[model samples]
Target: MEFLIAPIIVALLASALALTISILDKHVNNYGDVEININKGKKVLDVKGGDKLLTTLSSEGVFLPSGCGGRGSCGACKCKISTDIGPVLPTEKPYLSIEEINNNTRLACQIKVKKNLDVYIPEELFNAREFSGIVEEINDLTYDIKEVIVSIGDESIDFVSGRYIQLVVPPYGKIKESTQRAYSISSKPSERNKVAMLIRLVPDGIATTWVHKYMKVGDKLRLIGPFGEFEKSDCESVMICIAGGSGMAPFKSIFHDMLEKGEIDREVWYFFGARTTKDLFLLKEFQEMEKKWPNFHFIPALSDCSPDENWDGEQGLITDVLDKYLKSKITPSKHKEGFLCGSPGMIGACINVLNDNGIKDIFYDNFA
Candidate 1:
């Protein structure tokens, strides 16, 4: 009991010290107004200093893509700071490449706005806005995957298919602060007043927990979006799209948008992988799509499916199925491009398979 008490006292002291530092930083360290020059004068913000760059920008109506809600975990809130804001922090090193470090790219969430700074961001970010939405629908795509639809009354968002939006989860239960997470818009771009996201529950994940457990119909929500550069090419090359689980979101939007716009001339082969039939979703939806769009094909494979189950689709690792199709099923004469979205390991495996099939051009979004 005495040993446990010693550790408890140490933890208490550490917590007190942390709280004291936070209060001192918040109340004592006032850096006054700081000017943020964005995109070489395309936009300028005069904000209170001594706050995180991300919070400062958001308060000024500038929203950067922060999958972890400015917690310095997602590393998605990266921007080029041409001015010297000090060296890259240790928390940011794991996410940034050496080239990015050399270019002075820094995580906005980890940087403190101590003074005037020049930052370069994509012009499209200027169009991203915070939207007020009400939960309209929530359907379980699978045991783990959910289709969440939000209705944005009156106001509409204009975004290309395959882009993602950040869903803001307000504080609830034991959580003391709100958080935002990025989710690809599965709804078609033409449905401007509604947004749908396929969310896969991650154990103990702040945003996913709130989405799966706390979110309910008629609940008000905030979404900041139109971020991400994932989109279909206008070229005529056959598109070989591959995904697993919630990775299907972007492709769903892209295909629906293409179909709606009468751009089905391009051939597309979508390969969806899962461990079992129970893990798969949208079989009927994609099957109907395949029937309606002759040029589109949907191949769902299960690697570890039980023999007792009535499974008749491809059975093997996703890479193996992809390779098999590339060798025999797909036309060798036609130029092909690969679009992948999934875990880093899955994306790397698919890339190798695609490259071995004499395909070089590849684009991917890694859910890391």
Candidate 2:
């Protein structure tokens, strides 16, 4: 009787272990295949279901501009869906507007690929690429601004003149998850294998502080880019650009591209505002470029120049300097376009100045 009981117990234990193994396998490795139908018929991708839509699409080499890298915070990964994936998630609610929700738009990061999905994306996004790069050099462009040069590994990036890239910062000590931040490409478009960005250190900003304090030479980072439409148009109109602090990044790219391509036919006036001489940068480069491009003019304005600094230029607030220039230097009769980039406050002020001067075709990029 004892021998028969022992055999029965052994069989029961083996059955229990087999049941547990099957349950674990089902939970861990049972993601079924799913199909994503894009634009009804433009393209179709078959991928494993159960991952976030952003990650799955990115893995398939379909890059989407995401400032938070699919954490559902930046709300940059938004697309329209023809089929229902699931209800609107709480993480996506804050970023979606009422009109967006009504139009069947959803956050790609929040949606899970549980089943087959039909989604629509902008055609331009198909050109976006992700690149891995090593930090070549980091130089202080200004007191609080650092210019970082990243050398692309085996792949190269082809981006527009004034577009921006999202830099990926890995998790640090207190940071539980990685984060992404967008910075305009300061390097010329001709340098396809190397990208440069001018980053301003914001007091407690997660990414900026990391770049300023923790990041070192030769650190590896990933970047996803070529996003934004802040380029110079082909119209034969005067270009009036205004920027503050690190807002100089995009303008540098645009100006250099214009010089290299010999597209300096239209008159260009660049106004860079700073509190003092210490806050200013790239003056020598701009001066050299000004000599090269006869029609291009670079203006550096100091809002509060100390007497001891021997500063000599337009003074007062940036908007005030811009208003004076519009009234005195630039002619209102000629067709003009205003290009502005800066903090939200400075952009708003410059917009008002441009509007008051009858410059109707104003385009701007503000960092809010």
Candidate 3:
């Protein structure tokens, strides 16, 4: 009977503590109203406090790019905070560099708005807008990849070539709340009225599952514009662009924008990688670009191509092929910059290869 009484006492204590904490959260945590200073007085907002900074800003129509929809998972909603809120959180430390942390950079989704705060926002983000678009078409790029084209009827979006947009996925089945995911735009900037992106299916992923299973050609979707700073540099260095699978989106936009702007004279070598022939797509389109543009070279490599197939292209892992070309075909003295997009693991591997080959000034965008 003593053991039973001890367990009951412990349970009662736990319940009392939970009740006390809940009551305190209801009364003491009500931080009524707060002022948000943006860009040193470019824009100011008065909002109800006690919400995450990301949600509060979105409520005021100043949407920051949040790839995880205020879940604190994606580090995309970072901003410089001038006012003292608190130290950096463990959730944000993985995303923030030492320099960023030292400079008061914090993730908006992780910070609660408890007082008046000053923050810095880019001028370009001020121009970003939410767009409602109809799905024009959906084509199978590969077994696992699908090309989605969205048309904003009579509306136009102006953005740089290598940028991304947040795709708003509505709740379905078990998902009760909406979420946003970022995908690089594959369409050229000239196609102002349309947005195209390549999405690869990820197992049990919220946005990808919606796009793959629930979306149809006539479905209407909401998109947030033209976020990201992954544009091509203006220097005359030889461009070494590497990508795999759906990573081809931004480069497709960049290359076509270059072609339209008559900037194809700059030397470019695009190295695309896949596991097998079935995983490859957009071969003919890029090959045609190579034929018309004298300085553009397209090299698609397969890592696990079977011996029975009559494949003549570069065969090996992408990093190995890149090292071979860097050592043999390309001139070592020519200045070069590496542009990469892929999964984080692939990007890490490619960066190691590029650094080993004496190439620096690398720029990359990795999908989460």
Candidate 4:
């Protein structure tokens, strides 16, 4: 009789607690209108409070660089805050260095807009705008990679060669809201009316899955762009570019721009890494470009080449091959600029090699 009564009492307590929490949350989260000061009153926005800073700024046509789409995972949407929003969250600490923390850099996605605040973002982001485009074609470059060509229609994009555009992925199935992912533009800057990007399928990647499976030619999609600072420097330094998989996009744009503008005199040694012959692509095209443009050299290295592959090229890890070239093939007299695009591990490894070999001018896209 006591056991039954106790069980009923426990259930009643749990229900009462849940009801209290639901009531508290309603009032606690209800923050009203807030003012956002950008670059110290350069631009001000009136946004509804209680939303994350990233989404709030975005609502006002000011898109900050956000790779993970306000999940507070990517840590890309960083902005310096002059006002005291709060203490640094544990989620943001991993991405922010000690110096950055001291400088008041906060992840915009994590900060709740409880009150008026002042934030500073890069000046270039001011010009960035959302553009709608129709998918012109989806050309298969490899089994896992596809070149997505998009026609911007009446809108034209003015961007540098090595820059990228954020692809706006609409909600599909279980995905509740739209999200954005950045991909480097593979098309040359001369084709401002349209754009092409090399997209490689990533396991469980939301945007990649949508592109490979659900998307079709002529499907209209929205994208925001002309972002990123990775571009060719004005200096006539010899560029040593390295790429793996769909990392080939930006380099393709950069090289074409160079070739078209008769900047071929600025020597380039492009090292492309692949696992087998199957992974190697755009071979004939780049080879022909090399032959026509004397200053351009294409060195496609094949790592883990099987016997049946019948491949004869630079064999070994890409960094190892790079070491050999830096020592013997590539001239030391020319000021070298390293352009690397691949996995973060590969980029870090290559950066070490480049640093060891005295190539300091390194450029890379963060979204990679």
User: Which pairs of residues collide in candidate 4?
Assistant: none
Decoy 3 TM-score against native: 0.92
Q: Predictions ranked by TM-score, top down?
A: 1, 3, 4, 2
Off by over 4 Å in 2: 1-32, 71-73, 85-99
Which residue pairs collide in model 3, if any?
Answer: none
**Residue lDDT tens for model 4, 231-279:** 8888899989998999999999999998898887888999998888888
Colliding pairs, model 2: none
Compute the lDDT of residue 3 as modeled in candidate 4.
Answer: 85
Q: Candidate 3, residues 97-135: lDDT per residue as tens digits? A: 999999999999988898999999778888778899999
lDDT tens string, model 1, 108-166?
99898999999998888989999999999999989999999999999899999999999
Whole-model alpha-carbon lDDT for candidate 3: 0.93
The Cα RMSD in angstroms, rounded to one decimal, for candidate 4 relative to the true structure is 5.8
Q: Which predicted model would earn the best TM-score?
A: 1
lDDT of each model, Cα atoms only?
A: 0.93, 0.88, 0.93, 0.88
Q: lDDT for model 1, on a 0 to 1 scale?
A: 0.93
- The parts of candidate 3 lying over 4 Å away from their true place are 1-28
